[model samples]
Target: MASIKTFINDDFLLENKYAQELYHTYAKDQPIIDYHNHLPPNEISDDRVFGNMTKVWINGDHYKWRAMRTLGIKEKFITGDGSDKEKFMHWAKTVPYTMRNPLYHWTHLELARYFDIYDLLNENSAEKIYAETADKLGSQAYSCQNLLRKANVEVVCTTEDPTDSLEHHQAIAKKDLDFKVSTAFRPDKAIFISHDGYNDYIDALAKASGQEINTYGELCEALENRIAYFDKNGCKLCDHGLDKMYFESYTESEILAIFAKKRSGKELTGEETSKFQSAILLFLSETYHNYGWVQQFHLGALRNNNARMHRLLGPDTGWDSIGDFPQAEKLSAFLNTLDSKDKLVKTIIYNLNPADNEVMASMIGNFNDGSIKGKVQFGSGWWFLDQKDGMTKQMNALSNMGLISCFIGMLTDSRSFLSFPRHEYFRRVLCNLFGAEIQNGQLPNDMEWVGKIIQDISYHNAKEYFNF
Candidate 1:
């Protein structure tokens, strides 16, 4: 008789013996360095215990919310006042329908890894899984901090706005825990002059930095003050989310005039807006170089497509998609500007549009002056492209265009603590790719050397890159 294989078996994503050995030997047991994510710092600081599966899994997960909405589940059960179990049951019903979507694999992976409930989630199994998970979640062993420990996380770097207090990160630093927590400075609001409530956000930033900003110079000073504060508090990186890189030319006087106009609640022309954005982005990058911080740009997201839903539910509620922007010209100009000035810090650029995979991969090579290993990197696939196909294409592009051995591997980039399994998912995919190549005689049969490379991509490279 043949043995039965579970939906998420030991060899779930591994297709052959080489893949299994590589994963189990080199990829598994590697500590995670989640260098970029959106997890709430307060929960980790407080060590809060999320008492049920829905609270920990379904709530605030726009990924699940989007899927539920597509399956015609009502908003009440998805994101509104419905009971926790009700939302989960609705999600469970949508799981089978999520087949061929990354959600199907992610859902089961999370379930099996976190809750130890290996049975596939459906309407019939929902009740049992929910009850079992709720019981486990209600324990002290499942607190926010413990959840991270379960995932073997070594360092988790969360993203924060310029105005954030970072008191939670400060608090976490004092703890004697096994893992470390860091933050990334995200000043997108400060650079986006055309966004709604931009002035209001400026006011908040002023308060946080303890400086008044009536002029463009004052604005730069305020941001610089905050960067200093973040650096003092152990922030090692910064992140930006943009439709595309901004590289329009402008004079200081022009930028100052644009700032004055926007601050006075006066509308500016498209040219003025682009010029202001370009100037501020340049200023921030220069400041980041001075502080010796890594800079990351996540480009090509077409956010908030559903205006009506956005008005009702707010941003990041899963109304975003990939954007088709002319990335190369502006991106090349922007990086070249920094490189020419000799002020380019270690940089990673992530793209959401699959069409720009090779474009971004090749673009990073121009400015990689070899002062450091993988100095300017085409970052891993992000947002909509975090799936298996997306990750594969990104690695292939980088391998063909640049060096994959020095690639800083996966990050959760997720809001949920349970999402750490994504690192494992990425590792499995990476091992299978190399393992298949070895099997086809595309490369020499050197398991030791290949395994070492796999380990670097899995864990060591990021450890060296970030110095964490």
Candidate 2:
């Protein structure tokens, strides 16, 4: 227990004096700009409080779910009918085994930061910690909005589908909250013509937009309507999750014919699918540019791999992994098309595959064009790569290829409200990197200038880049 305390102490990840000073001085107090995440806006609007630890922490955390499954925990105790306490116990038991995993750090960081419970979460500490968190969670002081306040979050932009009402955002706006809650338009379903339920989703989109979609033009108009609605509701950004970019050449008439065939319940060929996706994606990007909105692309996730498990548990239930898609040529073509038309908006690209880190790093440089500061950003390490080693590699890649000082850094991209400490984790890692360089005399001992850059990467850059 004493060793565990020392392990997670104030200078947890900071190994040297310069590293500790950089973190505690310049980076520790920056307000979080979580520009992309999957938190439910309704929860923030309603200010709902969880009943217990598992309800808030365990339920819907696919990261933890994946680790537990890998350790052979039964489905009954994980995402099944087992009681909340039972599931939590299983998680607590799994903590010691998660030693080298990022979960180990995140778990303790969340517990310490949110609950002030520094004890290592395991079989021995689970009961006491569970009871303590449950007691605090039941209070109004620990409600969803208050949780964001505890993290000193300045702004959080939740992702919503085009079919969303944004009523919750309206509800949140009505109150005088300390922090701001904005939303992003996610049009993945509208673009995925080859996926099952594509037409069904179009029906939902039509209903939401109050437009009838009978043709490709109508589909675009309906999407445009939703975009207008989202923009009116204070959405300054949009997000897309795709395996890779689609740059297939197709005429407007060809896309129209493909849409007509898909609407007729005929399965389109792979070529047709790619063409339709490319057309819609281009349309969406152009529209976003017109609205002056930032666009984020989360690419290379090979989602829902285990069909057997996916069928049983549904998507995003620990079934996705990094994909090795060839991202260079098509991505360049897509961005070049937008750039040529002078319609490329502020863009951030996140690649899940570590192999493409340098590729993504250099790719952003091609379109920067001196239009804006870091106009096309190689985004932070995401999903499986949002850890110490991964973040270091990503920073190193960007530093090698481009300007790291101009880099806008770190977002939770998480569903859990308690996950805000990830920003702090990123700060620690970032400071350590800069501090290590200074100590090695590779960088001059200029704390103020360097600290300003640290703060910029930690908070200021995103604040200015998103302009939210």
Candidate 3:
């Protein structure tokens, strides 16, 4: 019998020789532009020294939490009061069951890439790998900033709310680190008018902007104030996570009345909520355009599905799923609304459902207008769709409908420090797609041009698109 090969070798996912060449020669060395993620800027600023694998890998990682829960592991070892070692052990036992899932690939890839440990994670090897990582993580070389450096990350943008002070970002700027850290303004809280704590959040926004919110007009003013502040602080982009685009028509008086009723703790009718969300979202988008900032909309998430678990663990604890919202008409109308006023800035639209890949792919071309090279983008597969099959479908859709050559490629959009290997995963997948097409004679065997295109998708495109 033949012996089993190494699980995560250099050409792990590169299938053909051309695929291997493209990845190694072009895609491997490109510095990553993790332009969107939920990594806490405070950790980077403080250069946090995480003490163990549990701290760096498992802590607050809903990806792992979801896996552990699916494997019949109890909440204690997953997210509750279990000891860190216990949690790491539980994770190791669960790793073998994750085969064929992206989590499995991500798990071993992170171990190999970050720790230089090529051993597959499982029950047999868990304790040894766990101890090895614990020792390295406890050392100074594994500090948060140093870990980012080890990944060869050139620029990374962490998301922040409108009310954020960005003190950590400021501190990082003060230090001149090798990598650049930036902020993207996320105003989801402000747009979510009918959410549970809208009024209280508005009050916080009021304090953040030094303006009292008494009317719909005043609310817009406060948001604009925050936008100006964010722009002054070197913000080049903004992000929105929504079920779908809202384009409901509303008069100024109607929006004002709705804001007043909500502020007074009155319940808003569904129509009233839609109108308010539409108005605020449009206002924010226009302001982003005026400031020449790229805007990203992560659409189609049905959040907080399991009410009991959600209430127990709070948001982003993995109770969310892809929402099959009707996207095209409203999304088109929303972008057209801004385009009619010539206020549509550089835009990226990410769809969570793979079924809408074609819709999103075609939607971007409607507004490309040749003013910029791929100005509006059908973004890479996101959220539930960030895996191999989903990414392949997204690239095929974009290549068929638009210019994949101009594509600004992968982002972590993750909360864990160990998630940077996701970029490598994306690059390998990207190269294999191009290489297969070359082998099939769909295009000439022009390795030079193909290599350039692959490299651009890996790094240069995002850098030029975001101008980071």
Question: lDDT of all predictions, in order shown?
Answer: 0.93, 0.94, 0.92
How many Å off is the CA of 129 in candidate 3? 0.8
Q: Write one digit per residue (lDDT tens) for candidate 1, span 136-236.
A: 89998999999999999999999999899899999999999899999999999999999999999999988998989889999999999999999999998
Highest lDDT against the true fold, candidate: 2
The list of candidate 3 runs beyond 4 A from truth reads 1-5
- Tell how far residue 415 is off in model 1, in angstroms: 0.4
- Among the numbered candidates, top TM-score falls to 2
TM-score of 2: 0.99
- Write the residue-wise lDDT of candidate 2 on 1-468 in tens digits: 423677678998997888888999999999999999999999999999997999999999999998998899999999999999999999999999999899999999999888888898989988999999999999999999989999999999999999999999999999999898999999999999999999999999999989899899999999999999999999999999999999999999999999999999999999999999999999999999889999999999999999999989999899999999999999999999999999999999998999999999999999999979999999999999999999999999999999999999999999999999999999999999999999999999999999999999999999999987
**Can you tell me which runs of candidate 1 are displaced by over 4 Å?**
1-5
Distance from true location, Cα of 44 in model 2, Å: 0.4
